[model samples]
Target: MNKFHGIFKQLFELQLPGTEALDLYEGYYAQLYEALTSRDNYDIPIVMEQARITGGPVLELASGTARIVKHIANAGYSVTGVDISDDMLAIARKKTEMLPQRIKKNITLHKGNMIDFQVDEQFALVILTATSISLLKDEEEVECMFNNIYEHVKDGGRFVFDLLDDESFENSSLRMGGIDAITLNQSPIPKQFILMGEQRDANHSKRALMNFYSEVIAEDRTYRFFGSTEKTYFQYDAILPIIKKTGFKIIQIEKKELAKNEMIYMFVLEK
Candidate 1:
């Protein structure tokens, strides 16, 4: 075992206290991915603490629905978010519209892939949360992504991100009851079902698709969106060389049990 820094426990509180079962509604693809995603409000505090620790303007890559970035903005930090999907950005934009004017000006959203996304400004911290980078799977993709992150990060700045390994997800299929949402600026997500499919491999890389049959109930209205999220085994050892070559030094590596049987490896890298 290796230890880099003293154990720092209890950063912030978690919202997903586990939900009690309730009857679900019959609906379609309308829910904004809050039910089964990090939007469930459990992981938000961890990422928020990361921002608080680093204390700077943030540049978040692969910013799906711009969840973490939005929260960072709400906390009074300036943030620039980049994502590849227009559909995801649209949902994020809708949420952004509901934020206060001051917070609205604090956030900037860009539609672009992680590999080649360009922003005019550099940030004191660059983040890739929700384990989104792990879905890249390919070694080259990971390398390119980090190289791009280096360019957007100022000297002596840090990059913090999380990686999820599909290998930890044991069940062939999994189910969770309706999560009681934490309200807006936080989420009004409702019921959801996630089926983690079998992993497929090619050229020593693995890919798994998590199919969500969602039935989300917002506060005032009901909406539902069924979607598939991809996960790939993130082999940190395989990418360590690439990361160092791109000029990032591993400052700290922390492991947290985000959920039962779900381990998250958070890498804090310094440029």
Candidate 2:
């Protein structure tokens, strides 16, 4: 496995330590869904289309926290949500366990890396949304990852993903400078969260150094945790070639405006 897959594999390896490190991820994952679903729906109609095409089972890659999975299941489709986060999966399991029997009967949660996860049966559609594809760090791995998705999807099945636009990628990289912080209201205990991103490459492409920090205030003690992740973005101009190299024909590229004056693109593909 490559470094990207390796990181996810380590994140999902079944163990308590795996769960502990993932606690932070679980918090963010839930917060993300709460924030997104509260305003604009994220791919609800697209997912509903997939549900209709399959007539039943849908496979979701990098399905963090089962937010979308629960929605898919509630819509009457059987869903298998796969993610490489034991911490996230632990919370997913608990949430699913608490569901009514009807919903619980149609959902399955698994610990698997996105690049290598497989099941005995082929799916009608496979989806990677919310820039989950961005998690893979570079081009070679991106190619490998797409190939894996193509391999797993059925002959007539469709693959879908959402990402930033190429033009936007260029525009942002040129004037990249920002420091924005977010605070999540839902926490196990009182906490303050801050994410500061510094733009590095300002020409050709978009690249940013994302620094994440969280301050937790327990009853008597205060703790701080910090980590950094680098995001290197691509334009649609640069990305289509890579998608074609893996035999994925881009069926549609839809763009929509977000509340924050950002345009998002969704790429729909088929084998």
Worst-scoring 10-residue span by lDDT in model 1: 2-11
Supply the TM-score for candidate 2. 0.79
lDDT of 1: 0.63
**On a 0 to 100 scale, what is the lDDT of residue 213 in model 1?**
29
lDDT of 2 by residue, 1-271 (tens): 1211222333334332212222334555444444434344557677677667656677898887777788888888888999987777777788789999899898998898887777777777888886777666667767887888888778877887878664664436533555567775454655555544444544424554444444555576654444345556666676789998999888888887655556668887887
lDDT of 1 by residue, 62-175 (tens): 777766877899899999888877667777788898988989999989998888898888888888876777668577888888998899888888888887644455321221
